[model samples]
Target: MVVEAKNTTSPHNMNQVDVNSDDRRDEQVPLLLQYWQAVSRYRIGIACIVLGTIALGIIVTLLMTPYYTATSRIEINRNQDKVTNVEGLEAEDVGQNLEFYQTQYALLEARSLADRVVRSENLATGDAFFQTFNVDPDENGIISGSDSRQSSEDRRRRFELAIRLLLDNVSISPVRGSSLVDVSFRSPDPQLSASIANAWVAQFVDSNLDRRFDSTIDARKFLEERLAQLRARLEDSERRLVRYADNKEIVTLSTTRDAEGSTVGGDTLISSNLAALNKALTDATADRIAAQAQADQNGLNKDAIENPAINGMRQKRAEIASEYAKILVQFEPEYPTAKALERQISDLDESIEKEELRMRTGALTRYSEALKRERNLQNQVAQLKSKFSGERQDTIQYNIFQREVDTNRQLYNGLLQRYKEIGVAGVGSNNIAVVDPALAPEQPSSPRILLNMALAMLMGLGLAGAYVVVSEQIDQTIKDPSDLKNRLNLAPLGSVPDMRKDDIISMLQDKKSVAWEAYISIQTSLSFLTSHGAPRSFLMTSTRPNEGKSTSAFALAAVLSSTNRKVLLIDGDMRNPSLHQMIDQKNVQGLSNYLSGDDDIDNLIQKMPDQGFWVMTAGPIPPNAAELLSSPRIKKLFDHLEEKFDCVIVDAPPVLGLADIPLLANAVEGVIYTIEAGGVKVRGIESALRRVRSSHATIFGAIITKVKSSGTGYGYGYDYQYSYGQQDPLPAPSA
Candidate 1:
């Protein structure tokens, strides 16, 4: 079979195909051709996109709601009198205001205030305001039942949430350097918003005052209990002091210079003496350890003769010996050496007795010193007791006084603090105040018809665009000729223009329509792939349904039959046969019946009167269409059709799903695909082409469908003038 490409001359350079120029132009012509092809082919898709966009915009605009906002302002004061001294916060009372407001804001969302507001506003029992603002507390951690089961906790959270929400909507600011706060609120109702904002501020202030009163009452009770205990303690300390003075036989001196001075001085002296005793004891211990270590003995019995007492005795004995020695210096050695020694020793013994008597006397003297020390210690202890007693009495009195004063003062301070907060709040300078009130809108904020229409169009277009993109991304069907070309690597045979325009009918009725000219051009173009002995049975197929496969087959068959040649149209699309719709043939039994059963072919076939064409439809959906078509019987049928008809056009099913196309393709001469320009994705086409290759089907190229044409006429400098909407070919050159 001889095969060829469409119109050897290519459009080049000017970004357009030149019916005006015989040769292809080089400057971006194919791109322009692609653009023109896309627009011409998918005009319906573009229209749907625009319409969908418009519809969406209208619906969204109508359904959206409108809300309004209102606000009030307040201020906070850390202290009424201390504001002026705040550093860098020299803005009157801003620092104090910020601190105070933080505390008060916490108070504003308190349960007490929330409960009070709820009751005072009477905001339950089917009130919209209640529904909007009243919180249903969940005792079981869920909101259920009717109206009255709402708890205080629920109410508090709601109010807090609202305050938070409103606060989000609410704008609060200090008056530059002042304690003033601007308060604002947002709601569907402007008046309600403003009212609720103001109410929160008022309730917060009142709650603060009430808290103070409660604190005071609590403090009062505490003080009363403390006072009783303190009085008892005071009496006990005094009684103890009196008994001590009386028992000691010491006068209880009051306000005496001697006693006061001496008592204090005695305390100082006792401290000093005890310190000295400790020092002496420590030194003695150290000395003993050193002496023992020097002698290297465990017991003092060996060293006791060198003890302090023994040492003193020895020294006296030495003095006596010295005297005896001196007397001996004047006496004769033989006279009485022994007598002098005895006399001196006796004198020393007498002196030792006297010294022992003196040492014995010192025992009482040491006891006396110890007793004096005790007395001094006792005096100091007594002074401590007195001082403690006096101070204890004062403490008891002071505690009692403090409790009473603090109780009353707590209440007073609370009231004062609240009053200051209120004062700060009322100045219209508090957080979140409305600078301007909501006014009735001069125009409706919705139902903008023109804008809605435009938006609807835009929305529709957007949806279509999205669908196009998504379908292009995911749908994976071969819809465009370019997609088929790029993916399938086959020559684009030709395109079929849309028939919805008046051109085709006019061409049919009076032989004067652009559609007629387009079909003729396509029919002429179809000749490129087949001629003389090469003209063979063509397999018409597509990727999926509703992509103009049926339409293309019918149109091409009709165009070929227009030649008055004997043509046969065979519906191999056993799954979906649409040819009957165009031919007005009632298909009770057709190819499926002929193939599967012993049905006569002569009775099953139908004929078109005007076109003089034969058709074979798939009758009803058959269970085993693929098996029947793949059989040797169907192979014989194709051979029989080709022998009789000048041309046989087989309208086949979508290639991806069924095995029938590849099954039947084994018997055909060549294949022709019906491709919609720019309707399908490149991936889908590639997949379909891959499937066809897997089945070993020979493709004859494609039939591009649903293309649009420009009616302008300028034929390669050989101008051919024609009326618009005319489809007839110009008269041939004089023969």
Candidate 2:
């Protein structure tokens, strides 16, 4: 039977250890390192893809026919150089430079220009032309049979084909921010490429000149027709104007002309006379006003009062009065001297009055004469104005005829001038000029080795990256311990490095082996799984068989035994027992016999003296394993073993396609899931976990087994290392 040792560490102390280590060993790893590790896993496949792509590129490059490219640079001016001072018919606006250059570039690639190049080179008749382009004339509907009509049609087709070939080979590239352009042609023959490139530019220049000359000729013809019409219209207008003026006796004395030499206004003879009479009438009116004012004042005017004779008499009278006054003062009142002085004064006064009267009469006569003169002048002015008004009425028609004549004359002169200019300008000047004539290239341009290689490399890398992403998505295996939490939402217990090739039983016995140390870590983790520290009894199972669950059970048992605890490992896989075979022990009687009501647990249990653990293997294959495991005897068997041993580990069958694991899981305190790295897919493990969880059994955690030393073996991010002393690195196990 099993003898249980005293529990040296209390459950509380064990729980503390478990709690301290409960935090997952999830270290922050560099993303680049993880990516590199993932890529490294598929390095061989990526290398094959890349190398194959590059090899294909090389083969394609070799098979491709060599083609030569010849480039001829040209300068296409927006406006042609003027040969003469006269402007051309087509005026160039500075704002339309973009449109002009675009047009020029388009013309360079024009089908007409290509045809001109083909005809000029006689490429349609030349076999070398068709051969260079790898075109068979007979196969391209260009066959010239004996039928004349068919032959003519074939010739036409061949000509069109040559034009198309020329155009296809030609490329026009314009230099940015400048008037420079490059005309290039590619062909198998270097000389042909050069010839075609040079010919393309030359033909474009010639076609441009022809188009300009044709347009100028058309403009000259149009202008000549317009000039003739305008000339006849002008003559008719001038004749009508002259006849109207003659019939109305409206002779133009003068005329006004604008800056453009067009008639603006005119003056006639009647208008001139009216102007002169108007000036004279104004002068007469002024004189009459002055004379009338003097007459009305009755000689009060200064000029009338200051008459020479009148002024002299007043002075003499004053002298006489003075003498009389002096004599009266000295002599008697009625003295003869006083009387004589008075008579002299009266005579002077009478002389002054006479002079004044004569002056007033002269003023009145002058006023009357001035008024008459003003009236006469006014009458003459009125007559002249009436005549001028009549002339103006007649001049309205004359002015209309005159304006018509002026417009016709202007049009005639303009057309004549433009016609003369077009005649002188001829075809004008060519805007396009070859800057650098094409030369026969020494090297081929296409099938570039380095360029093709680079492109192939890029393509290869793109495909490789896609493959990596797709494989990562398609692969649903548990590659790393993180997959446990990420995919299944289960905590990771510990990872055991793969020791399948090495003696796994010997490694479990040797404490220095990595496998033994990994199990010890799992044992430590299991201790902290619950508040009571490791469950008294736990079931170890996997999604599928051969996932190292049996080995894990043995390893865990050995690890617990090393801690001086009695561990009982039961092979619960009665359907297919593996623990007995793994430990090289006889399986005559085991759990199957105990569950079959043998009532002898001691006889069924065997002690492994080397591993310091007791094992109960699946002794016999039972036809009804699920039913037997479901029996109450299985629960009673685990209950009894719990008291006999410090820890009980049941290695159950795979959870999938079997009801035994769930039944055995209920008989244990918890389930310890053992998953082989990259073995079972995530969905299978999840399905198995679902079945195990349906039993209401506590899942302690999952143990990822068979992990390679290289981080890529599990998931690329897992970097767990287990080294014993100073040993050389182990070789990675084959998948």
Candidate 3:
């Protein structure tokens, strides 16, 4: 073994240098390569596709069924009873159709009509229809699959059930604003459907008429009772009012005439009395005022003047003054002053008072005048009012009797008219006649065959979509190159692409196929990814075992050898050694024995016969694989291999939980991580790669494994909708 100087970190800045010995585990090149190799090695999946397609086709063919159907139409109209040929019959009874249409529709639901349909059609005979339905008839003539009824009643019920089922299948609706109703039905048998529909119409007309007549009879009876009650009430009201008027002496209670007459009479009487009293009071007051003034001036009592005493004195003074005026004409004032005043004055006053005795009798005379006139007028008014009282009472009684007679006559006439009408049998009715009847359907209204089937297909597609959604949610798998490109943000190299094993093998054996030419093209991509042909040591591995790292590396080495490069293949997986098994070199001392210093360099080197490829296998399973790969000796081996070969390929152990690959990977030039299809948990692959990175290894981009011919571009045959045996033959590769 050549002793190569180790790269060192000098802590003391002296030649006494200590080395790291690559404490980091090498990248698991073998597992990554295995995964990628397994990806391309998907023979089992093609078999699965062919098998699944066949199975799916068979299942779909067996489960699907064919269906068939029948259809018909009728228009319904409302019937008019007491139909008048007169023009504007409809306009005359406006809004009458609205009421009749609704009521007729309700009457169509009558149980009696339903019964008639059942009885007439013998709809209870579904049992007898077994033969027509292709049902096996029993010894008792009942259908084989149907349950037997217990009695006639049960039979009728069963019949009704069948009718209702058929009826539900029928549809009846008015067509727009027209009086026409469209009746339709759907059934398996077209003729039976039409017959039942026509029968339903006939039955509907009969049933409608029966119901109308019955309703009108009841309504007429009720109206008769109402008319009787109203007549009696009106008569009783008239009689009571009449008797009340007769008893109250409320003659006519003429608010207008009587009110005016009473108003005028009351005003005249009140005014006359008030005026006479006012005049008497005024006269008496004037007389008293004069007497008071006189008494005050002459110093005599005013009441005495008001009475006859004052009047007499005033009269005596008047006579004396007159006599003095005569005497003073002849005599002088001094001589007559005594004679004219004193002589016979008392006798003269007596004569004068006696002369006007009637006028000066008393003040009672003035007061008595008003009293007498008021009394006389009052008596006259009393006499006039009394005279009218009896006449008013008589008028009231007569009016009462006349009103009673009038009311009774009116009520009697009303009753008599009604009685006469009834006697003559003049029947009246408020019931609206059916202008149109609800007819039975001529065809089934539901389960429209083509439409329903199309709907069913739609439902099936929806169900399929839901199933895919739910299934996709449950499945966990690495999907495609897009998953890497889009989700993982990794650069995607072109695919290695799956091909038929037969074509691949033939192309490889003959060295003459378009596919074989494509393999050469992959070599060009490899050169591009390998960075301008820089000779570098590579460690290959996947997340776990059985990925095709070894095969890909072998193939890559072979392809490189085709280009005349010296490609050395080293099996670095100490845990499981399969490459050595592939190369058929077992128990031949190589890496493990050489690392323990069991053999020298020239003695340990092995060679392959066919390709003259240098092949190295894991010499023995080591307990401390991680430590051994990270030892100084392994670094020496890498240095030697780097000098000896154009490209060194070390097939390493899986990086998952194993340090052997990561330790070895640090010594390599680059690492290629491999991934398997629908295998290796994503996090697990990431973790494995992380381990490779932490091992201080440089990495080539990842390779996605398991490119199935059916699932990828290589499966181009599927694009042609292949019937059977239509595959194109393989041709030779271009020179």
Candidate 4:
């Protein structure tokens, strides 16, 4: 039994799963189709935006004035002609220095260069040139006035304005990794543009030459003044040296040096002589002191140290005294030998005194002469010192004068060399040279019509797309059925194609019509919500009125009745009844009458004559419809109807701002939410679904009403006219 139950329930479960899957996929179809739908609907507007913008661009380009650009190329390098680079005057290492190229570019665009170009080309007064800059030549000229001061001021202003305008038309661009510069001038006249470009280069070269010549002239004048001052200083220093040397009698001489290095010339004779005499005096004084010391130590034996003659005499006296003393011992008192010895001793003493006196006299004489010699030498030395002092002063002054002369001579030589260099460089030509002359352009540089139109087209397309996106964001309407499925996770039951009033009668009478076909699809989709294929009772409601929920109820009931099922349609709205008008039926007896204590269920339920179903119209408008729907009597009425009918369809009122829909939703098996195409906001539909779901109502699906055939429709590629025309006839019965 368990295995049999599993086998029997498996297919049912699988079918249920398939239904859920189809519901999810159907919900996604609308979102995927939205962009393409919008494009199809607004393709004309987008085309117009792009085409209009492109046309406008073309018109503007055609109307604009053409401008021609003429360019001249000039070379600027760190290198220059060797002849022109005298005394390191030319620029060097320009390629290595970053600022050097920048400075050159600045000079190329300088106001001075522009002014020179204007003058060379004579463009200041040219009407054509002034017109290019949008300045009136008459206004730029000196204003006419009686006052001389005002005229002069106006002339100056005019000149400045003209120069500024000239500068604006000139452009200088340096070629990267090269020494070339592109000098471009733009003007309405091709010939003028070329002429101005060429003129600017010529004037720049001339200006460079002038600058170099001026600098050279300044350098020469400065050197001349410096040379004159140095010459005067040199002459003055030489004169002072010569006069001082002559007055002091000093001569600078080349002399050979002796071992002791004493002066040998006659001018140094007295000083030399004084030096010799002083040396003699020093010897003589030394000798005298030695002699005196000897006398003091020797005393009576002084004759032996001083003189030989005195020594010999003293020896003889000594021998005689010895003989006399021997004789006195023999002959007593009157010996002649003793007398002779005494006398000899006396004679020796007398001779010794004389010799001593001679020696002393010689010593004193030598000492006195040495003193005289010393005094004479001292006098000579004093005279020589005075002469030498005068010569020394003269030598010092000569040295100072000689140094001044040397310094002046050095400066003079340097200035002379520099002066020669300047004279050579002053005649040198400029280094800036034109590599290419300007030529008139064949075509105008401005008004690129094709490119401008292309850009305009792109911009316009971008703007149009932005407009579409912004409109889509601002518009919260549920335009596509997929929008409900993707945003609210609700499955769409069907799309009710827009109906013209003339087709309404045929739509209800003919089951073969597109409206009948659409309702049949809705009926089939609702059949899958329950095991019995169709819910016993389902309520249909919308967010607001005129959303066609009542009509959908009538159509669905008719489709179900065509299948030979007993279907009941109820006009559940009591506040504002609308279902009776859809079927052209009388509203005298219906749901409101039965719910208000009149329980004639059989009589109140009237059969829709040709619809193959029964409809209970909302009999009258009620003040308290919410209270009536909420009563237990309404539930009992639905039970009784369900027992009699195979399917029940209730056309409930709009869900928002009312309690009747929520109460009716609670009594039904499932709820069918309806939305108007491009009518109600998605937020309003979501709020209506919220109210129904909060009452614990089962949401079977949603249907989009009043869908258009092309622009705002729900279906994709499902045209009724084509289908009805091309569809093959129903299979004939087998014969």
Q: Give the TM-score of each candidate.
A: 0.35, 0.71, 0.45, 0.53
Error of 1 at 478 (Å): 7.4
Best candidate, lDDT: 2
What ranges in model 2 sit over 4 Å off? 1-38, 94-96, 140-150, 246-250, 269-399, 426-428, 465-538, 548-570, 575-590, 598-627, 640-649, 669-677, 682-717, 720-735
**1-735 per-residue lDDT for model 1 (tens digits):** 111121111112111212211221111235545444444445588787776666667667767554454545555555433332222112445545446567555555455665665555544323355344344433355445455656676665545554344444444444676556555445556566667666656665566546544654555566556555655654555555455545533332222124212211122233344456556555555554544353443223333434566567668778867766776788754557646665767876776666555554544454455555555655655665565555445444433443444444444444444434433332322233334433433344335668778767766766666665554456444443344344555655555554542233334434344444445655665565543422457778887776667766666676777886677888887777877766677767888887887448777778877656788887877887888886677867777778878888888898877898787666676677777654566677777878876765566667666542331011211222223443555432221
Higher-ranked by lDDT: 2 or 3? 2
Q: After superposition, how far is residue 637 of candidate 1 from its true place, in Å?
A: 0.6
Q: Could you tell me how far off, in angstroms, the CA of residue 565 lies in candidate 2 after the best superposition?
A: 9.9
Off by over 4 Å in 3: 1-163, 171-195, 204-475, 486-490, 497-535, 580-587, 598-613, 620-624, 678-687, 690-699, 717-735
Output the lDDT of residue 210, model 2. 84
By TM-score, how accurate is candidate 3? 0.45
How does residue 84 of candidate 2 score in lDDT? 84
Q: Which parts of model 4 have CA positions greater than 4 angstroms off?
A: 1-36, 39-131, 135-185, 188-194, 197-459, 501-517, 622-624, 709-715, 720-735
Q: What Cα-based lDDT does every candidate model obtain? A: 0.56, 0.80, 0.54, 0.73
lDDT of 3 at 181: 49
Of models 1 and 3, which has the larger TM-score? 3
